[model samples]
Target: MKGKRVALLALFAAVLAAVAIEPAAAQSGADSTTEKLIWDLNNQLMYIAVPITVLVEAILFYTVWKFKNNESPLPTRENRRLEITWTVATAVILLFVGVASYQVLAEPYVTATGADAGVDTVAEDEEILDVQVTAQKYNWQFNYPEQGVTNANTLVLPTDRPVRLNVTSTDWLHAFHVPGMGLKTDAFPGQSNYLLTKPTDTGEYQLYCAEYCGVGHSQMLGTVEVRSQDEFQSWLAENGDSGGDTASGNETAGNETGALSP
Candidate 1:
């Protein structure tokens, strides 16, 4: 009576807990390879550990219950074949995990992304804009070396253009992440790495510092503005910016070749 009711309530609580826990676990960091690797390994460990733990517990309980003192000094059988079988099975499972992760490892480019294939595929006379992202203790800054532009809290990109993002940190480690373009990378001090991305639809993508650097880590965030080529050009001109090459090409960002009037 009461026990049955208690059991039902416990099952309901478990179901609610599982539902609440799973979505948060799924969305927290599965979006990045680094986080996914951690998650995948944890999942595998549990999958294997749970069954092995149960089996070992069952064996221990059975042995104690059934053969407390009757467990004789009988012949011990060494099962080399069983050991080899389990070893091979475990290896195969690990191999499967490695193979399954290929897609995640290749996401920033290699798939529907014309970045490595070359940005010209998206539009004529256009190349991907390369931006260097640097991190500090409490904030993020972006540099468009070619454009001779530097700014904080705001990243501007031409819509429909590929961006080759070279990332690094000026202080501790930080992660550059923009969800809309499905891009994220670590900004490690003294070490430079890059990622490729294209903004298909024009919009503002939120940027966050994924790595915990200090007290303000959780508060570090920025915005990336994706605009049309013309709008970008206008914006560049408004900011008096030029790709290191020289705005001598255009007064705005989109114009590849134009000279600033004296």
Candidate 2:
């Protein structure tokens, strides 16, 4: 019994330590409004979850410690009050999770679907840059439909402005993920998925294909370069025609499965 008690205490301590260290480890270096929102949501959930976890673990440990020596323990009596209390608490927690998740998912910058397709709801006066993202076996292509510019393996966007990414896969299914910006969406073949975000900082962020495609899945990596509006416009003008041809040629040569062109 003493050994069991010691093990339980150690487990309780480990749980507490894990809860304490989770926030720091979970940080993704959010640098955009949508990313910040996601970060905030994670913290919110942690705040709620930590306390409940502690409470439940504490009760479990206490019960074990208190009843450990009872060799001829009596049958437990049912307590309606305790039962009702826990049931209500569980319902409330579930409700909170549902509402919080829905709030984040329903945001225009997080997801734009149904009747809100192609609509810029982030700001009325702000201009939204539309970029089409195409994923193949081992590469990514970002095309600015309005500017008639395209780039391979690198996505460029203007800071402080909303960006709409129409993501799709040319061959196999892939996922477009920018961890720093909290942007992730499935890129299905023949279907375009929209993801919206506003960059709050000017820096290079890492992009990855979150799904497994083929032998080259590990190499299916990309970069997101966020720059000032003026610099972004300059880059568009410089690469408007040349960039498209270069990206097309590179993709055509690199494509092993003969996927459809972006």
Candidate 3:
């Protein structure tokens, strides 16, 4: 009994060690919603599954040690209740996991969904600021259509209001994912894409290409800067560039462009 208890305790300790998942070292800010979902799910899953696993293993080990009969055939028994109990329990747990996490799936994405965001969309209403996000083989562009401002590699937004981003790619398919706000949108050539978010916290969040576009796909990176409303207006004035060379006026080496919706 003492040996069995020690084995069970060891198993439980091993299970508990895997439950604490730290955020990725390379990422910062409140960007990825997936990370938040991980935070929520890990605890529940650990608590639910770990003990079950440890207990089952402990039982198996105890049986092997206590009931080994090398000279005789192993006893075999059929227990319908045990089988059905396990099956139903597993199904119930799966169903609960799905239902409990529906909020994460239901959160509105950062998209004004143009060319398709429908005639009457909520994005039109929450349009405190409008910045156009575009994706290419390896870079991102942010254009402020209302202010006629454009730039590459960096994005700015105002606090406490809905910021609608109308986006599309001039090249292959790419995903604009920022972990902080739990937001991402696909940028497709010709066809338009949209993303919308309200940045409650003020900070800088790193952006990534969530899709594998091409050779330079992994090199693509961008940043989003959230500021106060007044500061944001000042930023619009300072970084604002004439839509003249604004037709993909990437001050950088190689850049791409696409038409964005209001």
lDDT of 1 by residue, 1-262 (tens): 8546545655565556556656665665443233344466555455545455555555566557656778565775899999999899889867766765564454555232322544434367667788877766555667777766776667888866667777788767889887655677788889876776666556787998887766666667778888888998787776654333332222222111112211
What is the TM-score of candidate 3? Answer: 0.69
Q: Which candidate achieves the best lDDT against the true structure?
A: 2
lDDT of 2 at 196: 78
Total backbone clashes of candidate 1, pairs 3 or more residues apart or in separate chains: 11
User: Taking the tens digit of each residue's C-alpha lDDT, what string does model 3 give over 46-153?
Assistant: 566666676677778777876686567666698899999999988998887787556444444322434333234344555556777888756788888889888777
State each model's CA lDDT, in order: 0.63, 0.82, 0.67
Order the candidate numbers by lDDT, best to worst: 2, 3, 1
Return the TM-score for each candidate structure: 0.51, 0.83, 0.69
Off by over 4 Å in 2: 1-29, 114-120, 256-262
The C-alpha stretches of model 3 lying farther than 4 A from their native spots are: 1-38, 41-47, 60-75, 109-128, 241-252, 255-262
By TM-score rank, best first, the candidates go 2, 3, 1
